[model samples]
Target: MMQLLIVDDEQIEREGMKFILQKSFPSLEVLEARNGKMAIEIAKTIKPDLILMDIKMPGISGLEALERIMEFSTDIKFIMVTAYDTFDYMRKAIKLGASDYLLKPSKAADIVETVGKVLKEIVVDKRSRAASKRQETVIQKTRSIIEADLVTQLLFEHVHEVNVDLLIDMLEIDRNHEVFVMNVLVPDSSDHPYPLIKEKVSELGNCLVGALSGNQLPIIVFRDKNVSFRFQATSFAKKIITVKQHHEALGWFIGIGNVYSELNQVKKSYQESLVAAMEYLSPAKYRFYAEIEIVEEDFFDLRLTTLKKDIVDQIKLGQWEAIRTEVLSLVQFFEQQGASLVYSQQRILEVLWVVSRVLNDLGIEAKSPLFAFQTIDYRQLRMETGQLLDLLKQKHIHYYQQLEADNVQQIKQYIQAHSHEEISLETLSVEMGLSPIYISKLFKEKMGINYIDFLTECRIEKAKKLMQDPRRSIKEIAIEVGYHEPNYFSKVFKKMVHVSPKEYQNAIHGK
Candidate 1:
């Protein structure tokens, strides 16, 4: 129970006030002292939360005791109770730390009202403190859990367009502003106290930092334009060093990546810094990863670079089969090289994004579930990377198959509609938004014949049917079938049908 002390020289006044207080507030554990000296001694043990002191007291004045007691417990509330309601006395008591006052011949209602007001203040103060604690907890979890997981998923795939407001709202970051990634690699995770370091970093304004939940503890820093990535990374490294030495948690390293302006590039920066820190993770020092050194290789197969170029060229040519094969080969190369799961996941996703950009260039939107990036689940499929590749290949197959069929339909429809308009593959190329070579190649693959061959077949078939119409001359019929001269039309007719136009006309007449 909360303790309240009543200090008075008169036994009757102390007992009377105690009775009224007890009746008004039964929750208070009321204690009494006859004089200021006794009040001080009793408070030393009971540590009363509120005091009712008389101005005139035996042994020592209430003001003197209050001054001394405040030196020990300034938070304790003091209420001066005196028979003299002089303004001078009131001023002196107020100066000596009295929170409130009561006049002589105090009624029960007045005493109850004064104590009740102090109790009410205590309740209000307690509520405020509780609210502050809850708010802090909410902020902590928001940055540590929700924000961290969302960030992780995004890094894995081109997940939906990132919610920029996520950082601004949860982390207090200005997503429009510049940001960079700082990695703190503590091999001995148990030794370094990251939460404390994160708390201190948060105290500094104009930055958002979060400790991800995983074996590798990465700290993402969203900073104002004034703070450079190098400076922030180095400063944070020093801070970690200080914390380590202070707490005797000594082995750790920090890696810093280049600063970026766009929020979408955060994952790129994160991967760069992560690779740097992971390279020399254990030396208890910091490294600026802005310039990751590339050592010379013994066997550099130029085909790897050639393969990437070849696949992109194929994308431009609209060869889905070739593009899909090259993409799979890239993954196979990464697997054969024994690249780390994280490294492979990052690189393959990048390669796929480059491939997806092909669709965007051709005014095609990528809507496959596999293309979502988040669905890849790199963390879960670290061992079964082949499954991810297979899923991606399937999506590519379905998307391109439908697209190729559409292309075939358009090409055939346009040909039938303008067969006599002197049509060529180049004209169809512009009409279908595809390269001439790709259109020809796809035409044969889908229609089972070369484009010109199909055109020749359609023309000859139309001419034979036109031969049944005796109302038109041979030259007019040639012009109608896209040939400018009757001789050329007769030559094509003889070559295709084994009979000249007049011979066929005579044969029809004889029949």
Candidate 2:
């Protein structure tokens, strides 16, 4: 039932309007106001769905009263009641947010029809306002969650329960039927796209529901039919728009999760979307799935198992070429299998992820020169794939060369130039102007050989060169390479070069 307030200065006009409304809408509850001032007060107190006001009231004109009433509650639909039908009066009432104007000598049926139409409109406006409020609340909570960095916190606690059922209830989804869980993540700080982000995702006009995950990440949850492939395509497009909008706005990275049948899968999708979003680190990525290509393979899946082991071995051996080869091979295999761009990128990321782990185990930084080069945002360059790849390769080679030519090479040069002197790690550090520990780490990474081992190899090679001259004794040659004590030098030479100093000399002379 709808509630209405009837306002007029004359008692007969008020009663007549009330009778006509009540008779027309038997379910409507009519309340009477004799003057404009009284109508404003009654509207404030009663909060009716519609207000019927006479324009020529004594205390305050109906239009004046309607203006005041709007201040109290703009939601109430007001229709001006007047004996006059001037264009000026109609314009003034509408400017004040009045629904319609009814003539005082108006036909009963016309007044009834106008009242009924205004009532229906008010109901619709009320519903829309309610939905808008709900969405704002969700946005607030999601923003709070993402900014809080709760992703790792939730994962570590093994707490998968995200109160999605309550959220679904708040979203007013029909509980009787099942809804597919679609999670979308945009790469912008705003959390969603501007124009198209909020558009309906399906023919039924179902909307996208989203919030921020604990990791300062945005997660959009929506529902549609999985049986219809067209629905899936539409859903993908909607999420892509969100990603594109955010990237355009804030240059953020966006990720999208695979479609899931159950709400329980939302958490997994949430995690995967985060990983997918990280692809922004490498640009021009698109919608990807979390569990789509995951096939259950036991230990007996020898082909993949062997491939994994091969990549792992090459990483451990510090064979950068082998690591690069195995990854490219895997990517090629997947591409040949008719994998989409999204699928290929996912596989490549997986390979890089493993490589990053191995580098970390070898005490390398988590982010490598290769990773950084591959991830440079090329959108600013406006370059195509071939150009971008060429640029990436140029950068990769430069960094790789820099990595190889760094402190280790400097240390190697210092060692060689001072082979005739008593050079130590301390002396080499001073010559290179680098801290001893820092030099050691650089040596290990670039040369794939430790400091003491390289120094020993250098000393032994110098000793051999000196021993080539028949005039040089084993002790003299040892002394020349910074070894003062012949016995200690001989011991070191034997240990390093696999022969006693005298034996080495004899072998060189064929004595």
State the local distance difference test value for candidate 2: 0.59
- TM-scores for all candidates? 0.34, 0.29
Query: Who wins the lDDT comparison?
Result: 1
Weakest lDDT window of 10 consecutive positions for candidate 2: 368-377
Q: Which stretches in model 2 have alpha-carbon errors above 4 Å?
A: 1-143, 146-258, 261-264, 267-319, 332-346, 349-511
What tens-digit string does per-residue lDDT give for candidate 2 at 48-160? 88888878767688888888888878888888876664557878888888878887588887986788667667645655675677855654454333322332232223332
Measured by TM-score, how close is model 2 to the native structure? 0.29
- CA shift at 406, candidate 1, in angstroms? 3.9
Which residue pairs in candidate 2 collide?
142-212, 146-216, 150-214, 151-214, 151-215, 187-253
How high is the lDDT of residue 119 in model 2?
A: 67
